[model samples]
Target: MKWWLIIILSLSIAFLGCEKTDKPTINEDGTKDNGKLESGGKNPKSKTGVWLTDWNDAMKTADVLNRPVFVDFTGSDWCIWCQKLEEEVFGKGEFLEYAKKNLVLLKVDFPRDIEQSEELQKFNEQKMKEYEIEGFPTIVLVNSKGEEIARTGYRPGGAKEYVKHLQELLQPKE
Candidate 1:
């Protein structure tokens, strides 16, 4: 009976340890399918409609568009607050619209369970070191020239408030 109980407990633990990870579908044009962003619900494509994982590609696009790059440094598979930010803010249409017009969205994920290519892993680690990321859900805003403009994290008050906060951050300091 004790053996059976232990087996059951082990199985439960194994199941609990398993986590679901969403892998973004890469398009032919090197952009990721925006529908897979772990955004809690079905995520509609932004008006600008592209999310790049590669830093060089995103920076080039930012330069071309004359827009800032909004980098989301997230532990997508493990962090609860990262998930909350995705669900409450990024998934909302308001933030998507604002991001579409003003920002080049780049997702730099540090997932524990999901597999990433070695090159990508190295790149992510290098960027994390460069930016001195200390926690999950660090949102770094960079200018078109690839200079860091601001850094932020998960905030309350949902999409509108988050957008307002980003707008404030993007404002030129006096």
Candidate 2:
């Protein structure tokens, strides 16, 4: 009886130690979220060239700059392809420079373990349905009026090649 009790207690302790933790995911962009109802970004236009998390802000900036909005819908934490897109293209200096000049960048992240506010959550959900996003790493280009111009996903090659592809997509159709 004593041996059985000891085994059970030891197993319980091990199981409790193995339980997952609810720690905040520190993003590459320097924002943190604990995985419920806090906004996912620093603020509206926190950094001039950084990606905006709010759609309205993105559109407003795009209109002011006369630039197209580059909306990246991604599962930032869990999606392999999304991470690849970030590493290969979005994180590169060349893309960042081009984006600052000609694009209002927006990041709509659906993280598996990050917290966002209720309003932000609703807004993201609405846009997800509105844009008919069917997968992770969906890159949608839209005009200042929020009309979708073109949509793309992960493409092979690095930042230069991806930038060239984006330039082609952003070209005005005759």
* Cα lDDT tens digits for candidate 1, 60-82: 66766678899999999999999
Ten consecutive residues with minimal summed lDDT in candidate 1?
A: 38-47
Over 4 Å off, model 1:
1-47
Off by over 4 Å in 2: 1-48
Clashing pairs in 1: none
User: What TM-score, to 2 decimals, does candidate 1 have?
Assistant: 0.72
**Residues 71-138 of candidate 2: C-alpha lDDT, one tens digit per residue:** 99999999999999999999999899888667889999898888889888888889999999999999
Cα error, residue 50 of model 2, in Å, equals: 1.1
Per model, state how many residue pairs clash.
0, 0
Clashing pairs in 2: none
For this target, which candidate reaches the highest lDDT against the unseen true structure? 1
